[model samples]
Target: MSGFQIGKDIISYVALGDSFTEGLDDPHPDGGNLPQGRYRGWADRFAEHLAGHVGELRYANLAVRGKLLRQIFTEQLPRAVELRPDLVTLCAGGNDILRPGSDPDTLAEAFEAGVDRLRGAGADVVVFTGFDTGFQPVMKHLRGKVATYNMHLRAIADRHGCSVVDLWSMKVLQDRRAWSADRLHLSSEGHRRLALRVCEVLGVPVEGDWSEPWPQVPPLPWREARQEDLQWARQHLVPWIHRRLTGRSSGDGIRPKRPDLEPLG
Candidate 1:
């Protein structure tokens, strides 16, 4: 791992996906305010891990809630292209599968289109992610949907010459402790594991657990905040706080700053 030079070569990374990629269940220090929507997912950990590997690289996450294959192509992918990212990681299709009318054919087409658009925009390496069907309620119900989506995703990525992270079959998914109460989003420890794996996929070196040690500080004003409420804060509040903290606008995890589409752009 030390022999690898990813630290010297890589710079920007843009993550595009659904709720899991957004880090829905992960807790936040600011009363769960950072994720704005599921903002604390692996993408956030990936960025922090990258900071350790590389210095001064831009990390952007454009993952959204309930986003489908088509939405990513029309919306998220375009914005990502504008960043001119060096590496692009996508973890979509979970929400598409959970949709009432979701069908494999429609999803396959959308994934293909999104991949093509990203390649056209000159992303050097695109890392794709698969669903963890066995770990969640909705995914368990649609287990078959995961295979169908991955089949298409793998085929498209192969044709385009890109890499993928098969989270569905990864051992991490088997651990109950890896997920949050929702059984979909990752817990803090889960996020740490995810960061290590994603670094391996990107051919980057990983060190440490990458988990944010729970601060000894007092808890948030509220006793509790669920995933849905956390998601709301992710899209609305986190960016505001990031701007305040750094005097620059950005989301905590993979989500990026696009003032052009502020107010949930």
Candidate 2:
């Protein structure tokens, strides 16, 4: 399946990544038994659009929330290989950055390991989704972290003969209207925007209308605070609360600095 030409034959794609790839905080459209946890991320949108353009193209999503690069290389990559995918999309590394006190070198190594393993497994087209650090306030320090990882990713993709999708350059994160309220995850509209990016990168015709209302954003199933939950409340919500108290946006109030990100390569 890996060597199958995409234009000549219908392709089979497998998506492997973390929460964004898994559609975390997005509602299931069908609302079936497991509907609340259905695939609603960019990968799903990419598959839907790719299906309409190609014949008999099938997709399998294997993205999990909070997945580290080590786990992806050690576990997910092999399983994805077993499926023998013609096209593969990967959107990992957020968890690695979000982890406590993570260094660039460590994250870079883990990321490269996954890419090496996947390329060795015969994936024809390998797409790496870039990081979107603009979504979270706390991610300010981790902006360069993505570039560090992507540099290695691009190098590996070139050496191994694969393609890459630079999500970081899309600037979707800078548009607050495109993001969810918490400023951590992508809204349904955001997912659609992401689907378009994937289609353009892969040279596949987009399937559905990009203007449609997307699947609703779902609630987090697990308990615990994300970096955004903490920083968003601190920067935005706290200032709003102070405004309500003092009835003044003119006066000095709590202000948090946005994280600095490296320029897109």
Q: Which candidate wins on TM-score?
A: 2
- What TM-score would each prediction reach against the true structure? 0.71, 0.72
Winning model by lDDT = 1
> Mind giving the per-residue lDDT tens digits that candidate 2 earns over 114-201?
6667666777755564565755565666777777777877776676677777767766446655676656667777787778876776
Stretches of candidate 2 exceeding 4 Å from the true structure: 1-5, 132-135, 207-265
Model 1 TM: 0.71
Taking the tens digit of each residue's C-alpha lDDT, what string does model 1 give over 177-204? 6766555567877877777777877776
The segments of candidate 1 whose C-alpha lies over 4 angstroms from its true place after superposition are 1-10, 29-38, 135-138, 208-265
Candidate 2 residue 136 Cα shift, in angstroms, is 4.0
Candidate 1: how large is its RMSD?
9.9
- Quote model 2's TM-score: 0.72
